[model samples]
Target: MVRTADEASVFPDVVVASIQMAPKVGSKAANLKRSIELIEEAAGHGAVIAVLPELANTGYVFSSRREAFELAEAVPDGESASAWIDVARRCKIHVVAGIAERVEDRLYNAAIVAGPKGYIGTYRKLHLWGDEHLFFESGDLGLPVFHTEIGRLGAVICYDGWFPEVYRLLAMRGADIVCMPTNWVPMPGQAGEHMAMANTLAMANAHSNGLNIICADRIGTERGQPFIGQSLIVGAQGWPIAGPASKDREEILYASINLKETRRARHLNAFNDVLRDRRDDIYDPMLGTGWPLPRH
Candidate 1:
């Protein structure tokens, strides 16, 4: 439901769903169909926001740049994006999902955000991983926060979560929640018992920023590249409210978040606030120039 500003103030709690699924390589139609079905299921279960995995429609592990280009489409105007917008409009919920975005001859690993009101925005993956470098350009648009009745929303993709700056920038802009669509591969030396690095990063960032984060991951092997699935929803306090679902399962994890509470939690005590405590005076103003020395 597209709540009015007054209604949002009256109702601060919003249920979010993280959909974990396996998208077959090159099977765009089937993947989108499955995504729609899962989104409908989330709506039926009372989710106001639904997040899907990176490359949810086209799948990961493309064979070549040519293959990736073939799967890519224009944002908000492409077939995949249009279908998702339609589903969001029909279900009366917000949808954040990953797609291969084409802008002329260039392609990007991107996420499209849509709502009951229609298209919202897109977030291109800033950090590329492994073979992705061969198929997509690094995102040029810096982190952007989108305003909604529920609260301010932001998004990042896969490897972007590894950098604290991504979450910090979003929180600095007053974001209450972030949608992460990822295809997590087993990290180097990852054992069966160790907690997935992706989940750990989500929890730590959410706690540090006092922001809710929904991480939706894909499962299964595509062209011999296996993806780990442990999709989860983290509360502002950095605790898992729903799941680190099974390593290889198609499921949706749900959690209810109160934007007011999330914003309120940033105050660690009377003397400190997470964002307020940052010593921006000493930190480098120009990002990507490497760390600067603190001024005397």
Candidate 2:
């Protein structure tokens, strides 16, 4: 974990708050109201950047595509996004939230970054989990980074964290910090083990890319699905700076990230200098092998 004194002395200070929001099952209006309350709370705590969990405006569990579609809304025009924008403008803070987006007839699990300046950008989930494939369409766009009052920020939805490539791509694209908003469910068997996965991903990605990684996960039960709220902030040195909270009531986690340390780490360690070490020419087989001898 990066110390506060070290962080204050090194880089421009930015306070990030991760909100563990509890969405009302299938109620967009109620969820939006609750999100606004959380945003105000974060702003009151002096947070420059605030992040909410994936599918925060509506519960993640759905019986069918119709349910997901019913909750989906347009980018800036959506009720959720508009409410978030209003809160951001009033609080003078930058906000990142995940929502079910409606593009024509198809639904996409999307994350939108809204601020006092209005909607900044949007990122749809690239990887869908299991039954999600049957409803939401996978995002095709690559990882993106945006310049804000707090500095360069990268946004990634839930399942996107499972892949290291997204982190590398964002880091290579000049993302100083990556913000992940997730609604991860704790299955029948795995209760507290999900934190390990989140920690490993945050540490490895931060260590390898020399960038800060902040995550916000949902809490409480929704439609019988229990979420493990392990919202946390990891430093550029691949260590937890703030949390690894367990599944419980809604909570807000705060941490300060040093941008200078990120640059220093990258300069000292050549992990981000992938061009000098990678051999792409010989790795074509990893994509697919043409080996075929027998046909049924």
Candidate 3:
């Protein structure tokens, strides 16, 4: 529930919103309705961009591939995508949200990027989590950054945050802000409601790449799997500016950010720039030698 600034007086570059909501399994109709309501609410608050949790339309933790396929739909043109696009257009805001994508017999854990003009692009989850391996294919669209009036935008979903290469690649492509649609679960053997490791990863990557990040996570248990809901927005300096919201609640977090600061923030002090200071010359050649350097 943190407000970055007095959104009323100071008009920052953009007011971004991260929507955290729990979607019921197999309840596409109800999910879509609820998502639309939340989106409208975000727009009402003057948010130029909004991010929603992963698998927002269909929910997570499907029992089987058949169940997943039944809930999945085509990207950009499907019922769920169209509804979100329509809402974004009506609200005059941009939206990044996850959806279960179906391409013929294959399925992808994907997120859709849409703007006031219309649909922008899609990002398939590069890394799949447990049980997801049986239902979804590895993302084929490497990492894509979309250019708009607001800034250069990129996206990743859920487990993709684990790989620093994902953020690096996007930053190398001139991404200013990265939208993450996640359904985070509690870490193995970790107890007491401390911050999820996922949030730390987001913060670290943001600082490393000098990029702003918006993370939206879901809450509640589906079937038997439980989702942790510590959604947050981190500035380029790698600090939470909005929230690590309630562990189990449906809410929206807003952050007023100037994406232009990403470039400035990279210049740490006077001499060190996060991206420029990278020892790429020493790292690139060794990358192919299986030396543990990030390839993508």
Best by TM-score: 1
lDDT of 2 by residue, 1-296 (tens): 55677566646778888888788768888888888898899999999889999989988888889888888899889788888988888899999998899999988888898888888989889999877898799986667789876678998887788787787667666778888889876544554454556667788888777778888898888767777788888888788887876577788889887676665666544464432234545755432233231110
lDDT tens string, model 3, 240-285? 9899999989999999888546667787989997776777668763
Candidate 3 residue runs with Cα over 4 Å from true position: 1-12, 285-296
Residue-pair clashes per candidate: 0, 0, 0
Pairs that collide in candidate 2 are none
The estimated TM-scores of all candidates read 0.93, 0.86, 0.92
Q: Give the winner by lDDT.
A: 1
Segments in model 2 whose C-alpha atoms lie over 4 Å from true places: 1-11, 187-189, 192-194, 269-296
Off by over 4 Å in 1: 1-11, 286-296
TM-score of 2: 0.86
The 0-to-1 C-alpha lDDT of every candidate, in the order given, reads: 0.91, 0.79, 0.89
Candidate 3: C-alpha lDDT: 0.89
- Residue-wise C-alpha lDDT for candidate 1, range 263-287, written one tens digit per residue: 7678889999877777777887642
Error of 1 at 70 (Å): 0.5
